[model samples]
Target: MNLVPLAAEHVSGHALLPFSVYAADGRLLLPAHAPLADVRVQAKLGRQQALFVQRADHDAWRRGLARAVDKVMQSNASLSQLAQARPDPVPPVQAPLPGEEWEHVVLALDRAVQAARRDVGWVRAVQDVQAQMRAMVCRRVDEALFYFIHTGSRRTALYSSRQALRCMLIAGEAARELGWSEERIAVLDKAALTMNVASWQLQDELVCHVGPIVDEQQRAKIDRHPAEGAWWLRHSGVTDPAWLEAVQLHHDDSLAARAPSSLTPGQEMAHLLRRVDRYSAMLSRRAGREALSATQAAQQACLGTDGKPDPTGSLMLKAVGLYPPGCFVRLASRETGIVLARGERANAPVVAALLNAEGASMAEPRLRFTTQAKHAVCTAVSPGLVHVDPPLDRMQALHVYLKSNGPAA
Candidate 1:
């Protein structure tokens, strides 16, 4: 018997199975001769779950399956070619004015976190943030990260939302560079933002804990967060299959190990999200561990725990740069600054010097071009190393400076 998705609206009512339908895992979902309702279809899709109906007619089902398989194969072939071709280095886009739109995102995320107990309102808040992010154009990922980190550090005691936003921005950038369509990129952005929402409390605790997790119960909850978050989104009325699937598999590393030939589109996006998530975690400062330097994070990401090369690692490193935006660094000249924009080379980035060689805070931020060896980045520093009278104001001023300098080529 040929199995087909229950969501194909064009299928005739007569074509549906007269017998009970089971999910892929053999769980009975729809009773015999049940009429397919739009709500039911949506709920199933929201979980990134699928229900299959056995074809009443074998011949037609075979034909449909053959066509579906062929299409997927063709798409995979094209993706393979695209992956092999080295993408040209695109100049970094200019940072957009972080006025109302940036504030809106922060507010929306805050509301979402607060409304998590109320599922519908929380989902609406998430959608609001997604809409704002989709509407935002030509904004540098680093700029977004800077605003998110600075704002979140001051506004909330929890770091989950901040980490979520960082992952979202990083994943969105990677998706764009990979030539994903805007719609797909938006879905990715939303998925990344909500990937850890279900277990925020637990995650916050774990992030603050020193060393590795020794509690099996806590470890299990952390491991199950992705699936739990996907379930919550489904119950909250999320109907996009791609968004659901990306969230469900965001923590799965096995997808990265799979050969491209055997991978599905959802798995491909999941690979990207997983890589970005790992990289973002490394750059973030947890309670006991200082944030890894951009260069160190890049190296760790490129070489996985098992010593295997990650397929998306190089792309992430290139996109983020050796001194990713929002990161603190000390220059060869003994000055300290925040990375402003990616330079022509991955190791070279434009930095806004906040401290002079003597460790005194500069009166105003000075833009330094790291392409010149004399002003090269000496080491990635932690934020605690330097003092800024008004941290957020200095960051904003640096953003304005980068904006005025034009896009990096």
Candidate 2:
């Protein structure tokens, strides 16, 4: 069983517990909805390093916390509420932030990676987490891409797992666009996310590390990560040859150009993973290097080692487009905006303008269709340059926004 560390606020005295709390060793310390007033439970909690709950319930617990906050905001409740009695186990649900779901999936994926350190239940943990991602991708590819793109630009922590999520989404979407079957897509997603299982912490550190790989042992570890990761996955109950091979061969892009008819499933997945892995990493921020803009990343991701457009790279472009949703772009009008959705053509994206031509925040975000010459994408913008946060939910509801009020006037 997977367990997540809980924060103190999860069991605040002002609200009932959202989920049963557990001690580090998995003993139930407090049942769901239990009041914290019990001195016995307080005593039990005092000796533990931190509280934990089953990984699956973590979301419900979080949603409950958000619910509580919304309630307090609406009803003028506060720490003052602690003095009064309350009986409800859960606060009423509210609309979640656009990026919250991405956060949950990435957190769950991280837990699954941590679970790999154990001999038991790692596969189930990974499958459960990735299944959630696949469902999101399937339900709405646009929404999934929107959150994925929007998320990576701002967050600075958990680089390994978050990068994996980015790769998984790219690979999954690319796979589906290629008309691969459901089972194939599932295996590819699992493989893409966990391909760095051996170097999860190493990647996280190196991404933020200012200097070169000076240590010999560290260099060797980096060199051997792919093979070692595959071995660990095999030992941890991953029996799919395709999945294991993808992890081992993930760094080799040379295989990406081979004919699909002649390749084994593993080789195909490895090729896709190799390209998308690098592609995703390029778009992500690193302390030591500047991140590439969306257009640059897309171009660089698809080129072969020989400096030419590659078949696999071409597939990614065809599938995800040149300016994928949630990426930033500069318009012909000099307004800076984030791509809201892929338009009828790849070069033309639906945009939500965040900055006027002068680089000041707009009176209100204006919707633009790159299909129109006046708003055509002139260049990709650095995400860091976008200080003004755009309304993510509204962008996701682009169709409604346009129907109610057509594209930028």
Candidate 3:
């Protein structure tokens, strides 16, 4: 056997050895032909610093390595082709305009669902749909959310779609902050969008129930939705393992109990989705209960199922910030405003003032930078707390105004 350093830089995919790979102390690192993508294998190799492989298999190993390299090259070329096939970029808008973008997205989703039901594999169409979602998410998160909320809120049963979108947004923002690559972020975005599709396909009345899903039959549907969604995606020709895995495990609470060492990359993404999903569901208004305020949602997200604090929950709060965009808040000056965007600090966000300190609605919304303590958020308030004239139009106008002003420094 020949000894070789098992550094990440040198290893790309699975490295096949004719015999077992061993560490300096003679502990077997991996069996022959095992994929080296496992984090445990990588960690063990890292700790050992080197591995021994059979020299007799050098020729066979070289052949296998070449095949692996060729496969990776082909995969990358395919991904590149997909990336290059992007649709024309939507132009930046000073004001959010009425457009058929949401309708188009919904139509694409409907088509995908139909294709899945027919057992027809239309991978290209699915990819295009994901591309559209990625574009909308990157360019206009607020506008995308506006459509999701309006459409889903109109039908109580489809509220989960709104919640899913919220979770997707939060997860996307958090992933971006973590410096994940654009491609990875896109995968995350698509995964979040489709993760709950199966559940949404159920009868609207059944999914829209206000309280906890205590009925065994209903709970069964809820529990199976993740896997069902993943199965649909797979049959529709989604070959991305990470994307498929994320959809399947998005609701797996057991991930919260696993030690970090045992978590896979897929599980890590699942963990993020789970946390965001729980938080979004809590903040969402349902049949019998009022939605939790942003602050309360944040507080709830910071605790584990057992009521103890969790680091991931804390990270989620920090990522989402004190006043996430679109939420209403009362300023220290008693002026009520809607958060426009995240500011330089998590606790502070740019806000558009809808009311004065005296509680009178403003004729035109004024942009306020909450970086200054006087303008900082006092607490999250209910939407009805503000006296917004022609509330819908004013809110839309304010969103446009915020877009025009750009983010506050």
Candidate 4:
């Protein structure tokens, strides 16, 4: 979609807007006919920084010039139009570069999350960043999982923020599957985003700290982060009790045999958060420790120490699939590939073959539907074992959207 820059007059105090407003980077700022009442929203457009409207709005005000030109031609008066006017050229609005949001959003989100930790006034800022990330996740869930999952391991600099965002996305995916209300999901997303707020900096530090943790203080902080994080959120003006409770109880590994459907909303949401948080942590490499493969991580998340299956974990698999996107796998035919999307069944996923049966890189990744016997997944494989560095952006853009602006059906 094309965009045009807006001046202050374009959006005045509390007026119902005629057109939707967007950030300079294409994020929606204010919807059509909505009042611009939030101080934080106005601040984004201040300092002469650019805010935008759809190009059609600009064209609407420009069409009058065209009408006057037509009127002069209809009059048949020679030299009546006077000297030719030299108009000052107005520059065209630029579009965001391809994959710019996906590439930049991770860093942008990290900054927002870190800023929020320092100041309690950054509520809207953090939520705004989360909304943009959630849009990307909802738009292309598999691509999002692939983008963050791959980035999450390669760089531990922003592990705390990246892991939290990944967990929020996973919760949203599962929540959508369970047919939860949008309002309920919003609360879940917020809780997931801030579950580790109390030890965010510590999380990033731990990721790069090699060997056994000799820091007893840091070890104790990790053990009590859940309750402490909830308290921090309360001081930050988080009013939703359920949201706080979810964050507080996020580490309740003691949940035994409790079904998701029977649990209270807060407990259910917390259980979902716990399942995703632990699942993502296993995939992200910690210091000298190698990350667990997707299969190993899933087994840990889904099964208890006694080998009993957790019902909510079962719900996660049903929602996100057995071998979710971003994990590498070996097909029955000996070809190695990356899972691109979850298929109808847990075992069958949409895969792109990176290496041939002979373990050589293919000229291009070949998309395979693992439902077919010839293409069924044989086992999970490590990223180091796959010889090719997957072209994530190109492969992501190749996905066919079944809807106008969302994941495929």
Best by lDDT: 2
Off by over 4 Å in 4: 1-99, 257-262, 305-308, 400-409
* Comparing 2 and 3 on TM-score, the stronger one: 2
TM-scores for all predictions = 0.68, 0.73, 0.66, 0.74
Compared with the true structure, what per-residue lDDT tens digits does model 1 show for residues 85-156?
Answer: 322222222334544457656656866866776767688788777776655534445667665543432333
* lDDT of each residue in 40-148, candidate 2, tens digit only: 6667667677889877677665665566666666787666763343334544335357677778888888888877877558778888888887765544566667667
What tens-digit string does per-residue lDDT give for candidate 3 at 1-409?
Answer: 2454344443443343233566654345565545566667667667765666544443445565566556656676676544333222222223233535555666666566445566555445555776777666554666555444333323354464455556677888778777778888778877877787677655345545667767888678887999998998877778888888888999898998899668776777888898888777666656665556677777787676687658777677667676676677888888988776667777788777888888888887777888888887888975434345325555555555555456664
By the lDDT metric, which is better: model 2 or model 4? 2
Rate residue 89 of model 4 by lDDT. 29
Badly placed stretches (over 4 Å) of model 3 are: 1-111, 119-126, 142-157, 212-214, 304-309, 384-405
Give the alpha carbon lDDT tens digit for every residue of 1-409 in model 4.
Answer: 4688888664453344556677665656665655557666566557436778888756653464455456666776356462232122223445455446666766776676677657886666667877777666654777777767766655576788789878887888899889999889988988888888878888888889898889999999999999998888788898888898899998896644576557778888888898899888877777786666778878888776677556667777777777878788999989998887878788888888889999998888888888889889999886656557777655754453211232222
List candidate 1 stretches off by more than 4 Å.
1-104, 149-156, 304-309, 387-390, 407-409
Q: Supply candidate 3's per-residue lDDT for 102.
A: 57
Q: Pull out the clashing pairs in model 3.
A: none
The TM-score of predicted model 1 comes to 0.68
lDDT of each: 0.68, 0.77, 0.65, 0.74
User: How far is each candidate from the true structure, as Cα RMSD in Å?
Assistant: 22.0, 13.1, 18.9, 10.7
